[model samples]
Target: MEKKKVKNIFVEGPISAAFIGESIAKHSSNTNIGAHSIFLGQVRSDVLGENVVQSIEYTTYADMALEKMAEIREEIFAKHALTCMHIHHSLGIISAGEICLFVFTSSKRRRAAVDACTEVVERIKNELPVWGKEIFADKTHQWKENTL
Candidate 1:
């Protein structure tokens, strides 16, 4: 099959697990993948010894986010011999402990798929311009960018 199965980029106003599953399924199909791996990122409570996180408000630098996601996808494709990959992240208010991002990858072998999936997720967190606000149980909040 052609290498076009790999998604160049995917941007959403609000992302979900179901949406990510479908996108990955479609991208991995008709390819020669022997294994598929997926990683789902959920916002969690607590930030540097603070109260429980009530919700997470995520924002982006608009065009920068798109550019960054595109770069991430391209880098993954360049470095991995994979069938396809898809990354989706939420764009609005997401409750704490709820999933906000997903990284899915497929390859001809299990090892490559797993490695590529891991790399893609790490890159997105490191390089994307997506900002998040952690809402505390007391109704206060603080902005945070992904570190490492």
Candidate 2:
């Protein structure tokens, strides 16, 4: 089976919550997934003791994010029998506790879907072109770019 069918990537500023949901729901209905799991990653208000994340401004390094996402999707489908997968991440000015990323995974069984969902999110965080900056409520700011 072709694993590339479910791969999708988008770079946008302040993406809407509804849009992300719809993206996941757009998968082919003929695909019968007995279980579907979604993970919503919210931008927290604080990071380390010296830093505060009142908002997050995410930026990408061009098409790199999409390429990495496709790789991750292929890995997920190869490892698990997933019916579909969707990943959506916001690109700018995300407020505290607002979602920065959303991951949706489906499979014929609950166990595989749950496991692949976790793995996909971890891969995205460790390998995507996306970079984020944290702006404090007090107006101070710092880049939250990961070493990965």
Candidate 3:
């Protein structure tokens, strides 16, 4: 059997708006795709008792995460009639209001694209071995909990 190829989905820091716009622009040429669904995960400042979160430091086991993502990609493709799908996640410190995760899915129909995008985002959050440390304004930090 041939070895499976894994796609790298990790970005250095925050995902940029220009990059997102460019991604959408690039897909315009693909006439087969009738609909596109996009989900952008933004860092939010939350108050933890007396401390307020300033930023979040994201980290992941690259190899494991890639492997798991590949599995998710396969599953999503099998379940949805998708023309294309892309996922990008930040791997470093991301400030509040900055984009950290981007999930884009395209399909001939709107339902498939929307469903696939939502499923992929949910899987990535619950299944991937990625961790985030919430850094507070007072220099205190704590591990973030994954919530649906």
Candidate 4:
């Protein structure tokens, strides 16, 4: 089988509510989709030592991440009855309470959409080459570790 082209999933800065709303609105035309599941990952303000996280500066080995994501997309398509899926991750800085990652999955069934969306997010966290530098309110920073 011919391999599908890998999509560039990075968005500059934080993902916006407007952008996400538009994405959902665009899918309204797909009448075959009975259910859609979305996962939005946000930057959290967590206290670490004497400082609180203000934002996260995200970076990635894009080529590797996209390649691995393509493999993931193909695998998910094979294993699930999904109608469509979209994944977007932020690069650069995203403030606390802002969206950093968006995963949208749809299928003709609710269970498929829900299960596939969760699995895709987990794989992206574990398998993709994305990194986040947690920047504290006190101007200090720490590299984030994925709890995959």
Give the Å error, residue 38, model 2: 0.6
- C-alpha TM-score for every candidate: 0.80, 0.81, 0.97, 0.96
Cα deviation of 84 in candidate 2 (Å)?
A: 0.3
lDDT of 1 by residue, 22-48 (tens): 776676446677888988888787665
Model 2 per-residue lDDT tens digits across residues 90-139: 88688886777888888888998899999988888888878888898677
- Candidate 4, pairs of clashing residues: none
Runs in model 2 deviating more than 4 A are 1-8, 11-17, 20-31, 47-51, 145-147
The TM-score leader among the candidates is: 3
Q: lDDT of each structure?
A: 0.75, 0.77, 0.95, 0.94
For TM-score, candidate 2 versus 4, the one ahead is 4
Decide which is better by TM-score, 1 or 3: 3
Model 4 over residues 1-148: C-alpha lDDT tens digits?
6766999999999999999999999999999999999999999999977899999999999988998899999999999999999999999999999999999999999999999999999999999999999999878899999874
TM-score of 2: 0.81
Q: What TM-score number comes out for model 4?
A: 0.96
RMSD, each candidate, Å? 4.5, 3.5, 1.4, 1.3
lDDT of 3 by residue, 1-148 (tens): 5556799999999999999999999998999999999999999999989999999999998999999898889989999999999999999999999999999999999999999999999999999999999999988899998963
lDDT of model number 4: 0.94
In model 4, what lDDT does residue 95 have?
97
lDDT for position 3 in model 2: 43
The residue pairs in collision within model 2 are none
